[model samples]
Target: MPEIPNEQKKAKMPKSVPFIIGNEAAERFSFYAIRAIMPTFLVAQFFNPAHNPALQSIAEARANELSHLFVFFAYFMPLVGGIVADWFFGKYKVILYVSILYAIGNLVLSLSTHDLSLFSTGLIVIAIAAGGIKSCVSANVGDQFDKSNLELMSKVYGWFYFSINSGSVLSTLLIPIIYKKYGPELAFGIPGILMCLATLIFWLGRHRYVKVPPTGVKKENFMRISLYALKKAFLYAWKKVFFNRQDKTVWETVAEKYSPEAIDGVQAVYRILAVFAFTPIFWALWDQNLSEWVLQATKLDLHIFGYEFLPEQIQTFNPLFLISLIPVFTYGLFPLIEKTGIKVTPLRKIGAGLFLTILSFIIIAFLQEKIDQGGRPTVWWQILAYFILAGAEVLVSITCLEYAYTQSPKSMKSTMTALYLLGISLGNIFTSLVNNSIANNGFFARYTGASYFWLFISILSGFFLLYLLVAKRLPEKSYVE
Candidate 1:
């Protein structure tokens, strides 16, 4: 092939980029709008509102459990969606179809407000729909560029994350006001409309995308090759234990029909998964901005400068801070650090984020202690904590988005993205289990008030030290070209 001109390479942004970013913005708005209101909405709709502090506290705790559990299911569905896209259909089809389901899920939530069972059913549908398309949409962005413009992938992913937080900031601020003013139906209905718009925007990009065809049960598929390798290893172990004999080494036992590329992709998947193992701890601390943080806001003095802030609206600070911080980190902080003769790797960023998370939770723990002592401290304390948390999110989440794409093999891109998302699901499960245990007066029930935040702080501190050791040893790779 002839060498591509430098000037041509400079104009590397794909036409389909706008469509993907627009769809992501609208879709994120729809998702965050619903999520922003879910906890308070659940407590208001189902539990006692008669000013009984004991019942109200119990109700709020249950709301936290239910909310986190819903998030657990939402994040878990990406695995199924990734498998379907990589093996049966392509990314575009999966995104298009699942987006329609997403719209329906929102509609169901809008109409089912009065009935808990119906609302729970709506949540389940939304979880499957939203999580299903997530991995495909992200992987599809990387698919748009090849070796000619692969350097632009990181910049595009940054913009993609910016679009997500843009939607989040708008929804987090607006949805609470809408819910308070109009009621659940209209509040929920607006998000459903936006989801439909997101679907339409994505569908308009169909012909522009460079759609990768599915592997479709091929023997050379990454999963097939990995499974064969595992089977060979098992038989080799069995023979050694009983017959006292050995066959070929494990790596040498992969099926011959599979190409070297397929085997390499399987190996890449394992490495990516190892890095993903430490992410759940980060997410477990981060996602509380949706539930526990908002709940904590209610105990604070929400009035700031003659304006009363809604508890749910306080969650807006995260995305708002993200909108500003992403650019600062991408354009300023990272470059400044690079100029200081220090290398900034993804694992390093993530490890630093773990430390920041511990700090944020310590602040939260202090604030919770004040609340328990009947001192309604200003909301600014939490906002200060949000500032720190937002910085950590910039380091961890955006870096992971770029890392997961670049490290993945072409054939398993969506699957690798799904595996990364599985970490979020696992984190939410951890949060849910903690909440459940507390609700049942189990072992965790002993940790109350400020101690709750301290518990996470301690857990994350240990993980932060361990993640440093892991990052030191973990190798980095890139396959964007």
Candidate 2:
């Protein structure tokens, strides 16, 4: 087969690219618009009527918990979503169906602005729709190319990243101002409209896309392979414990009908999951921008040069920083690191991100200490935290998508994406646990928020050091599809 020349790669982007990119930008905007103002909105909507001090305290804490839980469910739904797409619906149909739910969710939020119960119901629906398609959209972008035009994929994914950040930045900046000035109805309604637009754009590209049909429940499903791997692992361990040496032909003993490619894919899945295990903790730290950090900002002075910034608006910096830094790191910083003879593998990049996370928390610890001391610090302190944390996100989140797509077996690509997103869900669970523990024990973050952040710094630092030590030894496994 003749190689496609580099010049041709840029000259002809597939016809479907614009529709996908447009849908992503609109969908992201709709999601972020709601997310940006949720904490402030919750506190405003729920806490204002509480007359009793005890009820007020409960209201305040519940606000944070609800926000965290919403994000938790949003990330968690991808499991069911991914499964349906991989097994029955296919990515295109799943995305189309879910996008309608996404629009209705936004509509409910807007119409139910005054009633918290209705609003919460809308959020639940949105969580299902948004999270369901979350894994499919990027995976759909990957399905658009094969070896003939595969060279364009790298460039395609770069713009995909840009689309995510662009929508995020737009909504993060837009929604807060709209909420403050125009009221909740308009703030929520606009995103509802955008969700409809997202759906429309996705539908427009139906024929242009390179659609992947659902494989249904094959014999070599993830669960079976995982169980097989688990059994093999136990047998190997048993041999090591009793007989001294392990079985060398463990692979051969499995069902011979399973191709080498399938076995290799299963092994790769296990390895990929093991490497990605630490990411939930990473997201746990990152998701705080929407909850705890923003809550902290709400309590402090946000004034700068005769203007004040809302806590919700502070999230705008994440996408702004990402937009600027993703390219810089992609082109300038990563190349420089490679030039210095340091191997910058994906896992190592993730390890570096962990270290950067520690640094950001260290900054948070210091900032929280200032808040504890009754000295209202400038928003710059938290902005500094956002800056460093966004850098870590650039390193980790972008790399994870590439890692998940490339490392997965074709049959299990959506499954891999869901597993990747499940990390964020688990991270949200971790946050909920930490908060619940504090409620019970009254030791962690009871007196000073500084201590809570300091503890996170130590946790990440230990993990970062350990990951760097072990990452180099990870097997570079692959298969012929």
Residue-level lDDT tens digits of model 2 in 1-481: 8997775655557899999999999999999899888877777786555545444334445566667777888899889887789789999999999999899999999999889899989988998899889878888898898776787899998899789888988898889899999999999999999999999999999989999899887787667866776687789789888988856656776646477767767777777887887788888878988877877787677886779888888878877877778879999999999999997888878887888888888887888888878788888888888889888998898888778767777765666777888899888877767765554555453623677677767777777777777787766554334
Candidate 2: lDDT of 88?
93
What candidate 2 gets wrong by more than 4 Å, as runs, is 1-13, 47-60, 145-156, 231-250, 255-257, 405-414, 437-448, 478-481
TM-scores of all predicted structures: 0.88, 0.86
Error of 1 at 302 (Å): 1.7
Which candidate should be chosen as best, given lDDT against the real structure? Answer: 1
Worst 10-residue lDDT window, candidate 2: 51-60
Reference-based lDDT, each prediction: 0.86, 0.81
* Residues 1-481 of candidate 1: C-alpha lDDT, one tens digit per residue: 9998776766568889999999999999999998999888888888655657766656666777888888888899989888888779989899999999999988899999998888888888888898888878888998999887888899999899889988998998998999999999999999999999999999998889999998786667666677788888899899999999887777777745567788878888888777888889889989998898998998899998999999989988887787789889989999999999999989889888888888888999999999989899999999999999999998988788778879977777766767778899999889888877877778888666788889889888888888877777887679987
Model 1 scores a C-alpha lDDT of: 0.86
Enumerate residue pairs that collide in model 2: none
